[model samples]
Target: MAYCPKCKGEMPQTAAQCPHCQFDFPVESPTGEGARTGFAYSPLADFALLVSMIAATIGSVSTAIGSIVAVFHGHFFEGLFIGPIAFFLQLGMLVTFLRVTKLGEEKQ
Candidate 1:
């Protein structure tokens, strides 16, 4: 279930060299320090996502309140602006979270 680094081919678990490309494989240490494992969540990315989500939530709430107040004040155009901007910001944050999560998964 291992892949040969040189030939990019499937090699047997006990393979020392890639049969297809005659490339020598790096022997893994008994401590398992040489082989690359699965992907992990990066703390910085997670922190950024958390912050974005919080900001998006706050922005959305504020936008709703602002739009409602503006509507009551007869400022239709102002309400329109605030509502769309808030929605766009929330959508952007959701998309960002999804993209980063997908990237982390793919790296595994």
Candidate 2:
């Protein structure tokens, strides 16, 4: 599904014009490029999200690696006990972030 920018009405993706507003879908703008699609997009927000996801992924992997190393190095208490816990917590947070962000945008 797609949305009409004019009326913010829900419409079929193949719609040529908004049924509610009768706004014709632009085939070419004065700039000679086709109309842009979708709404509520922000480049800065996207970039920030990209950076955050990358960092979170790195952190999660490092925790797992650290845990394995600690156990092999005879630090079984910290490696087995603390490493898995920390890694799982970070992973949960990352998943939560992704879900919330996606839901928030859709509800907007």
Candidate 3:
């Protein structure tokens, strides 16, 4: 099984498009290797991904704590704003990390 880069949906290796999102797989060469469609992975990309994931984790935890504290202190608006921001930031980081790692694995 392989993951679709666009939708992150699981698909069979022989699938031409993602069943969930209809994302077309890149054409393969006659030698059976898929063509590159995005950034080539490097040691630098791996390092950046690691750092980003760590930062996102820390940020998410801190923001969640802070939001909870704010709500306890009667700052509803602040909690509301901070909570969603943290959630979206963490979600973005997770998706980015997954996509980069998946693409990197394909190269190997």
Query: Top lDDT: which candidate number?
Result: 2
In angstroms, give how far residue 21 of model 3 lies from its true place: 36
Candidate 3: what lDDT? 0.78
Which window of 10 residues has the lowest lDDT sum in candidate 1? 31-40
Per-residue alpha-carbon lDDT of candidate 2 for residues 1-108, written as tens digits (9 for 90 to 100): 989999999988878899999989764343332332334246776677677777778888999999999999999988999998988987887897799688656755
Relative to the true structure, candidate 1 reaches a TM of: 0.48
Candidate order by decreasing TM-score: 3, 2, 1
Q: What is the C-alpha local distance difference test score of candidate 2?
A: 0.79
Clashing pairs in 1: none
Candidate 2, poorest ten consecutive residues by summed lDDT: 31-40
| Candidate 3 TM-score over all chains jointly | 0.55
Which residue pairs show backbone clashes in model 3? Answer: none
Better of 2 and 3 by TM-score: 3
lDDT for every model?
Answer: 0.75, 0.79, 0.78
Best by TM-score: 3
Task: Summarize candidate 3's per-residue lDDT along 1-108 as a digit string, tens digits.
Answer: 989999898889888889999987675664344443334445676688888888887877788888889889999988888677876788788778878778757866
The TM-scores of all predictions, comma-separated, are 0.48, 0.51, 0.55
